[model samples]
Target: MTPPAPSDENLLPAPVLVVEDDPLMRQRLALVLDGLGYAREAITFSQSLGEARAYASNNPLAMALVDLGLPDGNGIELIEELRAQDPSLLILVISAWSTEESILGALRAGATGYVLKERDDLEVSLSIRSVLRGGAPIDPFIARRILALLPVAADHIEPEEPPRPVEAGVLSARESEILELVSQGLTNREIAEQLVISRYTAECHIKRIYRKLAVSSRTRAVNEARQRGLLP
Candidate 1:
Protein backbone atom coordinates (compact mmCIF):
# COMPACT_ATOMS: atom_id res chain seq x y z
CA MET A 1 0.00 0.00 0.00
CA THR A 2 0.98 3.72 -0.07
CA PRO A 3 2.14 3.48 3.55
CA PRO A 4 -0.49 4.47 6.08
CA ALA A 5 -0.90 8.17 5.61
CA PRO A 6 0.52 10.41 8.35
CA SER A 7 -2.20 8.90 10.53
CA ASP A 8 -2.09 5.48 12.17
CA GLU A 9 -4.21 2.54 11.04
CA ASN A 10 -2.22 -0.29 12.55
CA LEU A 11 -4.32 -2.71 14.63
CA LEU A 12 -1.97 -2.39 17.56
CA PRO A 13 -0.17 0.89 18.10
CA ALA A 14 2.93 -1.38 17.83
CA PRO A 15 5.39 -0.65 20.59
CA VAL A 16 8.62 -1.10 18.62
CA LEU A 17 11.73 -1.68 20.71
CA VAL A 18 14.75 -0.17 18.94
CA VAL A 19 17.98 -1.80 20.05
CA GLU A 20 20.97 0.32 19.03
CA ASP A 21 23.92 1.78 20.93
CA ASP A 22 24.57 4.68 18.57
CA PRO A 23 22.81 7.77 19.86
CA LEU A 24 22.45 9.66 16.59
CA MET A 25 21.40 6.63 14.60
CA ARG A 26 18.99 5.57 17.29
CA GLN A 27 17.35 8.98 17.26
CA ARG A 28 17.15 8.91 13.48
CA LEU A 29 15.47 5.50 13.58
CA ALA A 30 13.02 6.68 16.20
CA LEU A 31 12.19 9.63 13.98
CA VAL A 32 11.78 7.55 10.86
CA LEU A 33 9.50 5.05 12.59
CA ASP A 34 7.46 7.94 13.94
CA GLY A 35 7.13 9.50 10.51
CA LEU A 36 6.00 6.20 9.09
CA GLY A 37 3.21 6.06 11.72
CA TYR A 38 4.69 3.12 13.63
CA ALA A 39 5.00 4.87 17.04
CA ARG A 40 7.99 6.98 17.98
CA GLU A 41 6.61 7.90 21.39
CA ALA A 42 6.11 4.27 22.29
CA ILE A 43 9.64 3.31 21.19
CA THR A 44 12.22 2.16 23.73
CA PHE A 45 15.97 2.29 23.05
CA SER A 46 18.19 -0.50 24.33
CA GLN A 47 21.96 -0.72 24.00
CA SER A 48 21.91 -4.47 24.15
CA LEU A 49 19.52 -7.30 23.49
CA GLY A 50 19.87 -8.26 27.14
CA GLU A 51 18.20 -5.04 28.18
CA ALA A 52 15.45 -5.57 25.66
CA ARG A 53 14.79 -9.02 27.00
CA ALA A 54 14.60 -7.71 30.54
CA TYR A 55 11.45 -5.75 29.77
CA ALA A 56 9.67 -8.54 27.94
CA SER A 57 7.21 -9.30 30.68
CA ASN A 58 6.32 -5.69 31.38
CA ASN A 59 6.21 -4.16 27.93
CA PRO A 60 3.84 -5.22 25.20
CA LEU A 61 6.14 -6.07 22.31
CA ALA A 62 4.24 -5.81 19.06
CA MET A 63 7.43 -5.38 17.07
CA ALA A 64 11.15 -4.69 17.39
CA LEU A 65 14.22 -3.36 15.53
CA VAL A 66 17.34 -5.24 16.61
CA ASP A 67 21.05 -4.59 16.16
CA LEU A 68 23.39 -7.56 15.68
CA GLY A 69 26.37 -6.47 17.74
CA LEU A 70 25.42 -5.63 21.30
CA PRO A 71 27.11 -5.01 24.63
CA ASP A 72 25.81 -8.23 26.17
CA GLY A 73 25.29 -10.73 23.34
CA ASN A 74 24.29 -11.09 19.71
CA GLY A 75 20.86 -9.52 19.17
CA ILE A 76 19.81 -12.25 16.80
CA GLU A 77 19.23 -14.48 19.77
CA LEU A 78 16.75 -12.03 21.21
CA ILE A 79 14.78 -12.05 17.99
CA GLU A 80 14.75 -15.82 18.08
CA GLU A 81 13.45 -16.04 21.61
CA LEU A 82 10.81 -13.40 21.08
CA ARG A 83 9.65 -14.93 17.82
CA ALA A 84 9.42 -18.37 19.36
CA GLN A 85 7.35 -16.97 22.21
CA ASP A 86 5.07 -15.06 19.93
CA PRO A 87 5.10 -16.19 16.35
CA SER A 88 3.08 -13.15 15.30
CA LEU A 89 5.60 -10.70 16.68
CA LEU A 90 7.42 -8.60 14.10
CA ILE A 91 11.23 -8.41 14.04
CA LEU A 92 13.74 -6.41 11.98
CA VAL A 93 17.51 -6.78 12.28
CA ILE A 94 19.75 -3.74 11.72
CA SER A 95 23.42 -4.45 11.59
CA ALA A 96 26.62 -3.20 9.99
CA TRP A 97 28.00 -6.71 9.59
CA SER A 98 26.91 -8.41 6.36
CA THR A 99 28.97 -11.59 6.29
CA GLU A 100 27.32 -14.69 4.87
CA GLU A 101 27.50 -16.52 8.19
CA SER A 102 26.04 -13.71 10.31
CA ILE A 103 23.27 -13.05 7.79
CA LEU A 104 22.26 -16.67 7.52
CA GLY A 105 22.32 -17.14 11.25
CA ALA A 106 20.03 -14.17 11.85
CA LEU A 107 17.42 -15.41 9.37
CA ARG A 108 17.55 -18.88 10.83
CA ALA A 109 16.95 -17.23 14.19
CA GLY A 110 13.57 -16.06 12.87
CA ALA A 111 14.15 -12.41 12.04
CA THR A 112 11.32 -11.35 9.76
CA GLY A 113 13.61 -8.82 8.13
CA TYR A 114 17.19 -7.48 8.07
CA VAL A 115 18.78 -4.09 7.28
CA LEU A 116 22.25 -2.58 7.49
CA LYS A 117 22.72 0.44 9.72
CA GLU A 118 24.65 2.08 6.87
CA ARG A 119 21.65 2.02 4.57
CA ASP A 120 19.36 5.02 4.19
CA ASP A 121 16.16 5.29 6.27
CA LEU A 122 14.15 4.80 3.12
CA GLU A 123 15.57 1.32 3.03
CA VAL A 124 14.99 0.75 6.73
CA SER A 125 11.44 2.13 6.70
CA LEU A 126 10.50 0.18 3.62
CA SER A 127 11.88 -2.97 5.20
CA ILE A 128 9.98 -2.53 8.47
CA ARG A 129 6.72 -1.79 6.72
CA SER A 130 7.09 -4.79 4.48
CA VAL A 131 7.74 -7.12 7.42
CA LEU A 132 4.92 -5.72 9.53
CA ARG A 133 2.58 -6.31 6.63
CA GLY A 134 3.44 -10.02 6.55
CA GLY A 135 6.46 -10.03 4.24
CA ALA A 136 10.14 -10.78 4.79
CA PRO A 137 12.50 -7.81 4.30
CA ILE A 138 15.95 -8.56 2.94
CA ASP A 139 18.66 -6.96 0.83
CA PRO A 140 18.45 -8.14 -2.81
CA PHE A 141 21.96 -9.44 -3.37
CA ILE A 142 21.66 -11.30 -0.10
CA ALA A 143 18.61 -13.05 -1.55
CA ARG A 144 20.67 -14.66 -4.29
CA ARG A 145 23.27 -15.91 -1.86
CA ILE A 146 20.67 -17.58 0.36
CA LEU A 147 19.17 -19.28 -2.67
CA ALA A 148 22.56 -20.73 -3.52
CA LEU A 149 22.73 -22.12 -0.01
CA LEU A 150 19.24 -23.66 -0.15
CA PRO A 151 19.11 -27.39 0.32
CA VAL A 152 18.17 -29.36 -2.79
CA ALA A 153 14.64 -30.55 -2.07
CA ALA A 154 13.06 -32.05 -5.14
CA ASP A 155 9.57 -31.99 -3.65
CA HIS A 156 9.76 -28.24 -2.92
CA ILE A 157 11.71 -26.91 -5.87
CA GLU A 158 9.90 -26.59 -9.15
CA PRO A 159 11.08 -29.22 -11.62
CA GLU A 160 12.80 -27.96 -14.72
CA GLU A 161 11.79 -29.50 -18.01
CA PRO A 162 13.20 -26.93 -20.41
CA PRO A 163 13.85 -24.24 -17.85
CA ARG A 164 15.45 -21.67 -20.13
CA PRO A 165 13.90 -18.77 -18.16
CA VAL A 166 10.48 -18.40 -16.56
CA GLU A 167 9.66 -15.08 -18.25
CA ALA A 168 10.58 -11.39 -18.01
CA GLY A 169 7.91 -10.93 -15.32
CA VAL A 170 8.71 -14.14 -13.51
CA LEU A 171 11.38 -14.86 -10.91
CA SER A 172 14.31 -16.59 -12.60
CA ALA A 173 16.43 -19.18 -10.89
CA ARG A 174 19.14 -16.58 -10.38
CA GLU A 175 16.75 -14.10 -8.80
CA SER A 176 15.50 -16.80 -6.45
CA GLU A 177 19.10 -17.39 -5.45
CA ILE A 178 19.64 -13.72 -4.74
CA LEU A 179 16.42 -13.35 -2.78
CA GLU A 180 17.39 -16.24 -0.52
CA LEU A 181 20.65 -14.54 0.35
CA VAL A 182 18.77 -11.34 1.03
CA SER A 183 16.53 -13.21 3.46
CA GLN A 184 19.67 -14.38 5.20
CA GLY A 185 20.70 -10.73 5.43
CA LEU A 186 23.64 -10.53 3.00
CA THR A 187 24.58 -7.17 1.48
CA ASN A 188 24.83 -6.34 -2.20
CA ARG A 189 28.64 -6.15 -2.14
CA GLU A 190 28.92 -9.43 -0.25
CA ILE A 191 26.48 -11.08 -2.65
CA ALA A 192 28.44 -9.82 -5.64
CA GLU A 193 31.74 -11.04 -4.24
CA GLN A 194 30.22 -14.41 -3.44
CA LEU A 195 28.79 -14.66 -6.96
CA VAL A 196 32.01 -13.29 -8.52
CA ILE A 197 30.48 -10.19 -10.06
CA SER A 198 30.66 -6.41 -9.72
CA ARG A 199 28.45 -4.60 -7.20
CA TYR A 200 26.61 -2.70 -9.95
CA THR A 201 25.87 -5.88 -11.81
CA ALA A 202 24.61 -7.45 -8.63
CA GLU A 203 22.33 -4.46 -7.99
CA CYS A 204 20.94 -4.54 -11.53
CA HIS A 205 20.15 -8.20 -11.09
CA ILE A 206 18.44 -7.42 -7.79
CA LYS A 207 16.30 -4.72 -9.37
CA ARG A 208 15.14 -7.13 -12.04
CA ILE A 209 14.44 -9.69 -9.34
CA TYR A 210 12.34 -7.21 -7.44
CA ARG A 211 10.35 -6.30 -10.53
CA LYS A 212 9.68 -9.89 -11.43
CA LEU A 213 8.58 -10.64 -7.89
CA ALA A 214 6.61 -7.39 -7.56
CA VAL A 215 8.36 -6.70 -4.27
CA SER A 216 9.82 -3.39 -3.17
CA SER A 217 12.43 -4.70 -0.75
CA ARG A 218 14.52 -7.72 0.21
CA THR A 219 12.25 -9.15 2.93
CA ARG A 220 9.23 -9.32 0.65
CA ALA A 221 11.26 -10.97 -2.08
CA VAL A 222 12.52 -13.60 0.31
CA ASN A 223 9.08 -14.32 1.73
CA GLU A 224 7.58 -14.63 -1.73
CA ALA A 225 10.34 -16.86 -2.99
CA ARG A 226 10.02 -19.13 -0.01
CA GLN A 227 6.25 -19.32 -0.38
CA ARG A 228 6.68 -20.23 -4.03
CA GLY A 229 9.45 -22.70 -3.20
CA LEU A 230 11.72 -20.59 -5.38
CA LEU A 231 14.31 -20.26 -2.64
CA PRO A 232 14.88 -24.04 -2.71
Candidate 2:
Protein backbone atom coordinates (compact mmCIF):
# COMPACT_ATOMS: atom_id res chain seq x y z
CA MET A 1 0.00 0.00 0.00
CA THR A 2 1.24 3.48 -0.81
CA PRO A 3 1.22 6.04 2.01
CA PRO A 4 0.13 9.61 1.39
CA ALA A 5 2.97 12.08 1.16
CA PRO A 6 3.61 14.57 3.94
CA SER A 7 1.80 17.89 3.73
CA ASP A 8 3.35 21.16 2.53
CA GLU A 9 3.38 22.63 6.05
CA ASN A 10 5.55 19.76 7.26
CA LEU A 11 8.22 20.72 4.75
CA LEU A 12 8.20 24.35 5.82
CA PRO A 13 9.59 24.05 9.34
CA ALA A 14 11.49 21.96 11.83
CA PRO A 15 9.82 19.37 14.08
CA VAL A 16 8.18 20.28 17.41
CA LEU A 17 7.90 17.56 20.03
CA VAL A 18 5.04 17.24 22.51
CA VAL A 19 5.57 15.22 25.71
CA GLU A 20 2.20 14.86 27.35
CA ASP A 21 0.64 12.06 29.40
CA ASP A 22 -3.04 12.59 28.61
CA PRO A 23 -4.27 11.24 25.32
CA LEU A 24 -6.93 13.92 24.88
CA MET A 25 -4.56 16.72 25.84
CA ARG A 26 -2.01 15.31 23.43
CA GLN A 27 -4.57 15.47 20.62
CA ARG A 28 -5.58 18.99 21.69
CA LEU A 29 -1.97 20.13 21.63
CA ALA A 30 -1.41 18.57 18.22
CA LEU A 31 -4.42 20.54 17.01
CA VAL A 32 -2.92 23.69 18.50
CA LEU A 33 0.30 23.00 16.62
CA ASP A 34 -1.69 22.55 13.45
CA GLY A 35 -3.35 25.89 14.03
CA LEU A 36 0.14 27.35 14.29
CA GLY A 37 0.71 26.09 10.70
CA TYR A 38 2.60 22.93 11.63
CA ALA A 39 1.61 19.75 9.82
CA ARG A 40 0.96 16.43 11.56
CA GLU A 41 4.35 15.02 10.70
CA ALA A 42 6.02 18.11 12.12
CA ILE A 43 4.49 17.32 15.50
CA THR A 44 5.60 14.24 17.43
CA PHE A 45 3.40 13.25 20.36
CA SER A 46 4.70 11.15 23.27
CA GLN A 47 2.58 9.92 26.14
CA SER A 48 5.42 9.27 28.54
CA LEU A 49 8.91 10.40 29.49
CA GLY A 50 10.55 7.27 28.11
CA GLU A 51 9.09 7.71 24.66
CA ALA A 52 10.05 11.38 24.62
CA ARG A 53 13.58 10.57 25.74
CA ALA A 54 14.01 7.97 23.01
CA TYR A 55 12.70 10.32 20.36
CA ALA A 56 14.79 13.22 21.60
CA SER A 57 17.91 11.06 21.50
CA ASN A 58 17.39 10.38 17.80
CA ASN A 59 15.83 13.70 16.71
CA PRO A 60 16.83 17.32 16.89
CA LEU A 61 13.68 19.08 18.00
CA ALA A 62 13.22 22.82 17.34
CA MET A 63 10.96 23.04 20.38
CA ALA A 64 9.22 20.87 22.96
CA LEU A 65 6.03 21.23 24.99
CA VAL A 66 6.30 19.15 28.16
CA ASP A 67 3.85 18.20 30.89
CA LEU A 68 5.09 18.00 34.47
CA GLY A 69 3.04 15.08 35.64
CA LEU A 70 3.97 12.02 33.60
CA PRO A 71 3.12 8.39 34.31
CA ASP A 72 6.76 7.31 34.38
CA GLY A 73 8.22 10.32 36.22
CA ASN A 74 7.90 14.03 36.80
CA GLY A 75 8.41 15.99 33.60
CA ILE A 76 10.94 18.25 35.35
CA GLU A 77 13.38 15.34 35.32
CA LEU A 78 12.91 15.01 31.58
CA ILE A 79 13.29 18.75 31.12
CA GLU A 80 16.52 18.78 33.09
CA GLU A 81 17.83 15.85 31.12
CA LEU A 82 16.94 17.43 27.81
CA ARG A 83 18.48 20.75 28.87
CA ALA A 84 21.61 18.96 29.92
CA GLN A 85 21.77 17.37 26.47
CA ASP A 86 21.00 20.56 24.55
CA PRO A 87 20.96 23.92 26.31
CA SER A 88 19.54 25.75 23.29
CA LEU A 89 16.34 23.72 23.11
CA LEU A 90 13.24 25.87 23.57
CA ILE A 91 11.23 23.86 26.12
CA LEU A 92 7.81 25.01 27.27
CA VAL A 93 5.86 23.47 30.14
CA ILE A 94 2.22 22.86 29.26
CA SER A 95 0.64 21.39 32.35
CA ALA A 96 -2.49 21.87 34.49
CA TRP A 97 -0.28 22.61 37.49
CA SER A 98 0.18 26.36 37.86
CA THR A 99 1.32 26.50 41.47
CA GLU A 100 4.30 28.70 42.28
CA GLU A 101 6.44 25.67 43.02
CA SER A 102 5.65 24.04 39.71
CA ILE A 103 6.26 27.25 37.75
CA LEU A 104 9.48 28.15 39.50
CA GLY A 105 10.73 24.57 39.39
CA ALA A 106 10.10 24.37 35.65
CA LEU A 107 12.10 27.55 35.04
CA ARG A 108 14.89 26.28 37.21
CA ALA A 109 14.80 23.05 35.21
CA GLY A 110 15.50 24.99 31.98
CA ALA A 111 11.95 25.33 30.59
CA THR A 112 11.73 28.77 28.99
CA GLY A 113 7.95 29.06 29.10
CA TYR A 114 5.46 27.75 31.67
CA VAL A 115 2.00 27.57 30.13
CA LEU A 116 -1.01 26.12 31.88
CA LYS A 117 -3.25 23.74 29.99
CA GLU A 118 -6.27 25.79 31.00
CA ARG A 119 -5.18 28.66 28.75
CA ASP A 120 -6.91 28.72 25.36
CA ASP A 121 -5.12 27.10 22.42
CA LEU A 122 -4.41 30.49 20.90
CA GLU A 123 -2.43 31.57 23.94
CA VAL A 124 -0.49 28.33 23.85
CA SER A 125 0.37 28.89 20.21
CA LEU A 126 1.39 32.44 20.95
CA SER A 127 3.62 31.27 23.75
CA ILE A 128 5.26 28.77 21.40
CA ARG A 129 5.87 31.55 18.92
CA SER A 130 7.32 33.78 21.63
CA VAL A 131 9.73 31.11 22.80
CA LEU A 132 10.79 30.45 19.22
CA ARG A 133 11.78 34.08 18.94
CA GLY A 134 13.88 33.98 22.15
CA GLY A 135 11.19 35.83 24.06
CA ALA A 136 10.20 34.51 27.47
CA PRO A 137 6.45 33.92 27.46
CA ILE A 138 5.26 33.75 31.04
CA ASP A 139 1.51 33.74 31.50
CA PRO A 140 0.25 36.99 33.05
CA PHE A 141 -1.65 35.25 35.82
CA ILE A 142 1.33 33.07 36.57
CA ALA A 143 3.54 36.13 36.62
CA ARG A 144 1.26 37.75 39.17
CA ARG A 145 1.24 34.61 41.26
CA ILE A 146 5.02 34.47 41.24
CA LEU A 147 5.28 38.16 42.07
CA ALA A 148 2.84 37.85 44.96
CA LEU A 149 5.01 35.17 46.48
CA LEU A 150 8.11 37.31 46.52
CA PRO A 151 9.23 38.89 49.80
CA VAL A 152 7.34 42.16 50.11
CA ALA A 153 10.01 43.71 52.29
CA ALA A 154 12.54 43.54 49.49
CA ASP A 155 10.56 46.09 47.52
CA HIS A 156 10.37 48.40 50.53
CA ILE A 157 14.11 48.52 51.15
CA GLU A 158 15.67 51.39 49.22
CA PRO A 159 19.27 50.96 48.26
CA GLU A 160 21.77 53.80 48.56
CA GLU A 161 21.06 56.57 46.06
CA PRO A 162 23.29 56.36 43.00
CA PRO A 163 24.88 59.44 41.46
CA ARG A 164 22.63 61.60 39.31
CA PRO A 165 22.69 60.98 35.53
CA VAL A 166 24.35 57.55 36.14
CA GLU A 167 27.72 58.30 34.53
CA ALA A 168 27.60 57.58 30.79
CA GLY A 169 30.78 55.59 31.21
CA VAL A 170 29.15 53.11 33.62
CA LEU A 171 28.01 51.04 30.64
CA SER A 172 28.84 51.89 27.07
CA ALA A 173 26.10 54.11 25.61
CA ARG A 174 25.04 51.27 23.25
CA GLU A 175 25.04 48.69 26.07
CA SER A 176 22.95 50.95 28.29
CA GLU A 177 20.56 51.57 25.44
CA ILE A 178 20.17 47.84 24.85
CA LEU A 179 19.66 47.20 28.57
CA GLU A 180 16.87 49.77 28.69
CA LEU A 181 15.11 48.11 25.79
CA VAL A 182 15.58 44.74 27.48
CA SER A 183 14.00 46.06 30.66
CA GLN A 184 11.07 47.16 28.53
CA GLY A 185 10.58 43.47 27.67
CA LEU A 186 11.66 43.74 24.05
CA THR A 187 13.10 40.62 22.43
CA ASN A 188 16.42 40.72 20.62
CA ARG A 189 14.67 40.84 17.25
CA GLU A 190 12.48 43.75 18.35
CA ILE A 191 15.46 45.56 19.86
CA ALA A 192 17.42 45.02 16.69
CA GLU A 193 14.61 46.43 14.61
CA GLN A 194 14.10 49.44 16.85
CA LEU A 195 17.84 50.20 16.96
CA VAL A 196 18.39 49.59 13.24
CA ILE A 197 20.97 46.89 14.07
CA SER A 198 21.17 43.23 13.15
CA ARG A 199 19.70 40.64 15.54
CA TYR A 200 23.18 39.16 15.99
CA THR A 201 24.50 42.55 17.08
CA ALA A 202 21.64 43.00 19.52
CA GLU A 203 22.25 39.53 20.92
CA CYS A 204 25.94 40.33 21.29
CA HIS A 205 25.08 43.48 23.20
CA ILE A 206 22.80 41.54 25.52
CA LYS A 207 25.54 38.97 26.21
CA ARG A 208 27.97 41.73 27.03
CA ILE A 209 25.37 43.33 29.28
CA TYR A 210 24.91 40.07 31.11
CA ARG A 211 28.62 39.59 31.58
CA LYS A 212 29.24 43.18 32.69
CA LEU A 213 26.32 43.22 35.13
CA ALA A 214 27.27 39.77 36.46
CA VAL A 215 23.71 38.59 36.06
CA SER A 216 21.80 36.19 33.87
CA SER A 217 18.18 36.26 32.66
CA ARG A 218 16.36 39.45 31.68
CA THR A 219 14.46 39.69 34.96
CA ARG A 220 17.67 39.63 36.99
CA ALA A 221 19.35 42.07 34.66
CA VAL A 222 16.49 44.52 35.09
CA ASN A 223 16.61 44.15 38.85
CA GLU A 224 20.37 44.74 38.89
CA ALA A 225 19.94 47.87 36.81
CA ARG A 226 17.27 49.29 39.12
CA GLN A 227 19.43 48.61 42.18
CA ARG A 228 22.24 50.55 40.58
CA GLY A 229 19.82 53.39 39.74
CA LEU A 230 20.43 52.95 36.03
CA LEU A 231 16.69 52.86 35.44
CA PRO A 232 13.80 54.69 37.07
Please tell me which predicted candidate would have the highest lDDT against the true structure.
2
Q: Rate the local accuracy (lDDT) of all candidates.
A: 0.72, 0.76
RMSD of each: 18.7, 14.3
Stretches of model 2 off by over 4 angstroms after superposition: 1-13, 152-232
Put down candidate 2 lDDT per residue, 1-232, tens digits, no spaces: 1122235532323567899989988887877776666657557789899999998775556678999999998899998888775566679998898876788778777888888889887787788767766888998888888788678636754554332232222667788888999999999889989998656457656755676677888998889989998877
* Steric overlap count per candidate: 17, 0
Off by over 4 Å in 1: 1-6, 11-13, 151-232
- Model 2 pairs whose backbones collide: none
Worst 10 residues of 1 by lDDT: 159-168
Q: What tens-digit string does per-residue lDDT give for candidate 1 at 62-113?
A: 6788888888888878877887655556788888878877887887777888
